[model samples]
Target chain A: MSEGLTFHFNVDGEDFTSAGQASVMMKKNLRQLGLPPEIIRRVSVAMYEGEINMVIHAGGGVADVNVTENYVEIILTDSGPGIKDIEQAMQEGFSTATDSIRSLGFGAGMGLPNMKRYSDYMHIDSEVGKGTTITMRVNIN
Target chain B: MTVKELAETDIFSPVTLPCGGREISGVYIGDLLSWVMGRASSGQAWITIMSNVNILAVASLADTSCIILAEGVTLEQEIIDTAREKEINILKSEKSIYDIAVFLSKII
Candidate 1:
């Protein structure tokens, strides 16, 4: 088998109904690649959270996943309004999502925290007006 | 018990058979998708009142046995069609989340 595989997706920010589609596909790809269940779950959860965040805060974005021998890497990029405070955003209960978003059962302020919780490594790069790009990795071991 | 048996019970009404014959392992009740995503285990039935398409995402990622829409929550046809397409089992119930949990506890 190859040492690595990459998958790219264009997330549509206009439709909330279609969020997480990328993560679902990624899960299937990981399963087909014969990854361990635990590793697959972690990668899926982290990627799913990032996908949701992209839709909720960034008005959609791009997701790229690279799977290698020892780890799975997820990179999400969005051009929506950038985060004003990354520190506050990382808190478990601090969300900037509106009430409408909350009614959809998201905006719990848990997305970033949960992503970090599931992934072995995570990094966030953002500017106030430009956009944000998050990178997360889950180790196979 | 299998999901088929649970759906056959008076408490549950089968909406989609994607998990018709799958075995039931346990139950987790919550409306918060993130919480459910983090806590739900494979083969367990997830109970929630939120009927949006996001439920499908959580159910698929968690690999749940079935999703029970408690309190007579009706879902849109699009959601149902998606569930069918995704091969996700969905059940509807007129009972409260608490009642459904109690019933599931007794059975599985």
Candidate 2:
């Protein structure tokens, strides 16, 4: 537990229903590691929002979680359509998701905002037509 | 009151009550998954019109007592099965969102 314990998953881009499985499993893992409840909730919620965003916007991506003594880090990388404007995407109630995505109770433009809300630090890097990478960390203290 | 007791009141019908013993202290209502995830307390009953599997993730993440699907929103069989396996409690109500919230306010 002194060094970083890493976990990785390939988020399936095809199925909408299968999304968030990675985040759910990571919650269990964090529980077994005996992290604080609030910390676990923050990491789970942040990772879950990121996972959902990947499913809805990107074609799917990779989620890597690194747990260490100081903090838990979540990295999401997607190859689907890249976000054209990070500023607009981060605004609440603003979304590029279609009507169908909204019908599913997602795409409220809360995904990235929620991720940022729950995490201690967040960074996003994206190039339109290239890909997007999101990094978030929740401090243990 | 526990979730089991709330389901027994008959206003909220049980879809599956795998973790019915969780205590209910308050109520929080919302449909947006992310909104509910951050705002819903750990021990409140979450009322929503959304009937997707993602609700399960939100309930578990927020650690809510149970999910009350307002407006008589029913869940699919597969989702119900998943709820059971995941040990999440779920209930449905024929009442509208507001009426259900009022009822919950009085009872819980």
Give one digit per residue, the lDDT tens place, for model 2 in A12-100.
88999878899989999999999999999999999999998898888899999999999999999999788898998899888988999
Chain B TM-score against the true chain B, each candidate: 0.97, 0.97
- Give one digit per residue, the lDDT tens place, for model 2 in B1-108: 999999999787789998888899799999988889878888999999999898999998888999999997989999999999999999888999999988888887
Runs in model 1 lying further than 4 Å from the true structure: A1-3
Where model 2 places Cα greater than 4 Å from the true spot, the runs are none
lDDT of 2: 0.91
Supply the DockQ value of model 1: 0.82
Please write out the lDDT profile of model 1 over residues A44-102, one tens digit for every residue: 88899999999998889999999988889999999978888999899897888899999
Q: For each candidate in the order shown, give its overall lDDT on alpha carbons.
A: 0.91, 0.91
TM-score of chain A of each: 0.97, 0.98
Provide C-alpha RMSD values for all models, in order: 1.2, 1.1
Query: What DockQ was computed for model 2?
Result: 0.78
